[model samples]
Target chain A: MDSAAADRPPLLEVEHVSFRYGPLPVLTDVSLAIREGDFLAIIGPNGSGKTTLLKIILGLLKPESGRILFQGRDIASGGVRPKIGYIPQKATHFDPLFPASVREVVSMAFQASKRGLSRRQGEEAAIRRALEVVGMAEAMDRRIGRLSGGQQQRVFIARAIVDKPRALFLDEPTTGVDAGTQDLFYELLDRLNKREGLTIALITHDIGIVDRHITQVACLNQRLVYHGSHAEFCRSDTLKEMLAGGHHLVSHVH
Target chain B: MGAFLTYSFLQRALGAGLFISLACAVLGVFLILRKDAMIGDGLAHITFAGVALGLFLRMMPLAVALVFSIAASLGIMKLKERAGLYGDTAIAIVSSSGLALGLILATLSRNPGVALLNYLFGEILAIDTVEVVLSVALAAAVVAVIAVNYRKLMFMTFDRESAQVAGVRVRRLDALITVLTSVTIVLGMKVVGILLVSALIVIPAAAGLLRASSFKKAILLACGVATASVAAGLAAAFALDLPASGTIVLVNLILFGVLAARRTPRA
Candidate 1:
């Protein structure tokens, strides 16, 4: 997998990205590459800048010094933004009283992806296909806040994927989900990665997700601790000691 | 009913009220959903400062109010974006200072007490042709901006970060909404008064979102509720010989109460 990934130019590259809040540094010269069709899990301990790094890559924040390149083009120059979908960390933390149907929320991604005087051409079909992929077709007309936590996350995933993004980034998608639902969520992500060949980068504290679903692993601690195949990550004695030491990694059981 | 149609002042008040209601209700839905509802209230306070400053200078109060509130609204947005202050905290800081400034200005401009009271509580029946024309123009602008940016605004209101990732130009839209809201609040001052103007913005939207199944329905229902309440409140105020702003706000509160009662069982 490493050789294969190396053979193809990386789909997304984060080079020497550093960020700070006020005077205190949050990320210190961190860099990693995400290849096409690679299901990479970014794991780190609390305050490890895992989320901040993802925000920079997604263009939510400006890096102090580094740059992000998508398909070998600097995204800052800004022609067509790399078709990427994001489910933010506070995705499910939206106001419960917000009145929006599942279909409307999904369709918003389609409308929002386009500029000015949006024509609703193919919008319904796109929303339906996205919902069907997320196994949420049955709840298309239901209010999003009426759904359970895991189901809401699935709807958000549908929203992210409705525009048919080349790569998907999710920040802590299953933070409040139940144990049983977490398994199903991971299964859905696995299907997206394997069956649909969608590239996925996820920020998680769950070490278990790396073993179960991720093909590639990028461990971060305000820096790129490791970025390689899941097998290499598991076998590396140095990383295992670092994980056991609880300095750079925090693993959640369920 | 014939008198309502015949009185020129009543016609002007109704004309301005309906437009103001439509603008407020539509803008209110986005503000309510974004949890930035207090912004209308905040801008209303700033409008008070504007009015007081204008009166002290012996100038057109509404124009001064519009400019002052717009600048203050942008300041609030900057504080939230750059200073990392929470929305309510920023609103509170700006709004309290506005109220204080208005009080000082009112004191300095002494004996404009009757004119100040007219603005504080609203004298809708006394609305003139110019105020009515200004209301129509500003309300039209508000509707146009919202209609043009409807999709982006909905996406942003639902989830700001995801909308940003989708390249929605969220900050620009945020500024647009804030400026539009400031304009709406300033226009509302004549119909509902500076003190109760936000009620016209919030109560109807709250009622609409309480029962709406879709975003479109929420907006439509809010507009419906706002317009209906203004019409009813005007007639009731004329009959009861009460203050127009208070009556209009009461009518909105009643409608919201009814909707809440109907919704509580289902929730």
Candidate 2:
């Protein structure tokens, strides 16, 4: 709310969202707003609907009730989903022998997200720029599986950004990365947010993300316990109570 | 052997076998990556029963196999969805039953004992012009489908959940892949026999993955290896008086061995 970019219309809107598996309510009455240029971190313990909320925002899962709007249009109305970049939390490995270069892998996403043959000349340039942003341009032809976990995540980020999305969503981006790499990852995200003005929604239980790197924070324990500026979240009693209750599930430094 | 090229049966057999090999390799890389390699085995098992059913009914066995394989492919997907069965488990359920039915039909049929063998272990020399034409058409269709949906398929294969979020129709594309692979399996059965046909689908793709650095190159190399194997195997059989299907599978195995060398991490 303190950022200069807050004057613009909100890029994503979620209202009264609720979802559940057969008998268990996973996310109940979840609601939040993400504006342009916001570096919002959705923080929660495992199975706290962090991933489920991200998926619903990404339009991969339909909330049992309520709705998500991207740029003020219903996400279910379609066509806007592609403009949102997503980095999944689940670590599904492609076989080490599966033949796909970083460029090819990104191209698959680029082509699918764009609905074109990708013969356009600028498409490659855009792809190159995206990879360059992630420091992967130099190794675009390397087999994706051969890269280190951090590098693979970078490539995945580049894949998401190739379309120059209005907002980026990441689910546990540093789940498998080492501490050193985690620092570098946040630095890259900071650059993307501050320098490029790209909106970001990062899902992590790691309240460890340096306070300066995040503009806003939403605390969740199957419900939105807090949604406000990072400064306010740092001062909240809700953070203390949630951490006290779910401290066992949170393994990261806060 | 050169004079044998003048025989219409030999020419038809070569053409049909090579086309089928190309198609199988096209579908194989995706199948192998998806860990659905046994779909080939499963479909082939169903294809055997289809052939037997066709023979018993005095009809086109290839058509019967096509219907049977397609149904089995969809059935496997449905079973995996509804029964929460692993991909291979569903395949095993349908495939074992397919083999049993095929065996019972083979026992009751009036054809020569070798007729069942002919379907199980392909006799390339026996391929007629009609089968050749059908295979050619099916191969083209398979290649076209892959071409039109190449990006979507790759995205799904590499990351199904992410692709779904990107608005790609993951379910439809998965069903399409299963159906295409099923048809490829049926057509391939006539070239490599039901027993070894998965080889034509799986091995070339495996080799291609080992040697190639990109998906496009992997698919291209897979098709190339499969086509070359069929040609080499057919020629080797013609020269050595061997069964052409088994020779083709041998050629594929040898190619896989050579290509696998490159897959090791370099020091």
Candidate 3:
């Protein structure tokens, strides 16, 4: 939120990242940086490698050539990963056959981080706080698949942030939700960014999110076409160029 | 029932059957939730080849079958990962190869005989003490791994990609599941035969998923269903003069039918 926050060191950086699927290139020399407390949206058309970049950053996929740094350290060195969380694309559509309660769903974050044979400790408070933050504390014991789409999305957000990760990444999180919930969802991201100072990165084709909530924008179509503050992105002709280039952009209203 | 239990062979069969059922039921919950339920059937077919190879070599049949099934399970995983084949496609290729190889070996062997017949359609009543001990040991190992890694496995099953991001070691856990499923399948072949072994791994778990409100309950319900079915199916087989393997699967199918028919709220 600070105007000169970019002057400070970046919290996360992607340097000279390139990725390919066999012979086809998905991303080419894509590079970007996220400063602390910034709400950045990685905007791109459908095939623009947005999710691929996110996967690379999350260490789910190895880029063909690149290095990812968290707090100026190579992430591949196998130290403790900088505390970060992810809510994957289409997360709300998780198998209905997964018979876990809302509490159990949130508890998975802790379960993944736990070590040794020691029993789960202090995670109860963490789970409760996360549920309360998402306002799903009342549904803690309910089956996750039984919730409405919006509610499930919030529960996923809680699961993502339950560990108090310094950074949160989301991928097309509002694909099937109604418009009403999308507005509230963006507002929730806004609150987390402003109040908690959590660094946030989201990938979506929705151009409206770029205008409304995000502080920085990184436009992608196989390359880093534009990366700047929201004000600069709006003041430039880049949006016009992207539109004329026939890249798909969904313009929606809250 | 008491009189039947008095027979030593009946006791051996019952003990081995119950343990194998518990192992299958627990692992089945994961297999069903992960949508990899058919891996059990695939591995069972592979077990058929393993048994044939054991017969051909005149070796410890269960040991050779165990090795064959585990290797084939790993092969299925590799085919999915490295070969870029769809999961079911890879399973189909590996399982059919196993069946074909098994048939060939049986044809080539001078006396494939009732020993092979017994494995194809389980002869639990004639199970030896060594096989019962092996069944109990392997089943306990499978159940222990599930208990120890239950939470991590649950996370991976719920959302594999997110679980990887969370550093849950998805690949290792996936390998662990396949290997454990391999063990369960090999043990289950003795109780329900290679043809019907997957029924023990899939049906009870499906029944649990049908109505349980939580994962813990689902596992508990699946175990209960599997244990009861095996017990009743074995008794019915004795009383009605039927094959235990077929009877066990029929009971499982009937229970699944009853569960499916019950009314429940759906999201």
Q: Which candidate achieves the best lDDT against the true structure?
A: 3
TM-score preference between candidates 1 and 3, better one: 3
When 1 and 2 are scored with TM-score, the better candidate is 2
| Ranking of predictions according to TM-score | 2, 3, 1
Ranking by lDDT: 3, 1, 2
lDDT of 1 by residue, A1-254 (tens): 46887775689999999999999898999888899899998987788899999888988889999999999999889575878999998899998888998888988886554644456788888888999999999998888888889889999999998888999999988888788998899899899998998999999887674467888888887888888988788777646677677654435322
Q: Give every collision pair in model 2.
A: B122-B193
Shift of residue B101 alpha carbon in model 2, Å: 1.8
Estimate, for each residue in B1-267, the C-alpha lDDT of model 1 and write its tens digit.
887678888889889999999999999999998888999888899999999999999999998999999999999999998889865999999999999999999999987788999888888889999889989989988998898888888999999888888988988998999999999999889898899999999999999999987888898999999998999999899889988889999999999998888885222
lDDT of 2 by residue, B127-233 (tens): 87777888899998898888778888888888888788777898998899989988998888888789998998999998887777788899999988998898888
List where candidate 1 sits over 4 angstroms from the true fold.
Answer: A22-25, A115-119, A246-254, B81-87, B264-267
Each candidate's interface RMSD (Å, one decimal) is 2.2, 2.3, 2.3
Predictions in order: lDDT:
0.88, 0.84, 0.88
Total backbone collisions, model 2 = 1
- lDDT, candidate 2, equals 0.84
| lDDT by residue (tens digit), candidate 3, B1-267 | 998788898889999999999999999999998889999989999999999999999998889999999999999999999999965999999999999999999888778989999998898889989989989999998999888888889888998888888888888998999999999999999998899899999999999888888888889999988998989998999889999999988999999899899948853
Residue A87 CA displacement from its true place in model 3, Å: 1.1
Candidate number achieving the greatest TM-score relative to the actual structure: 2
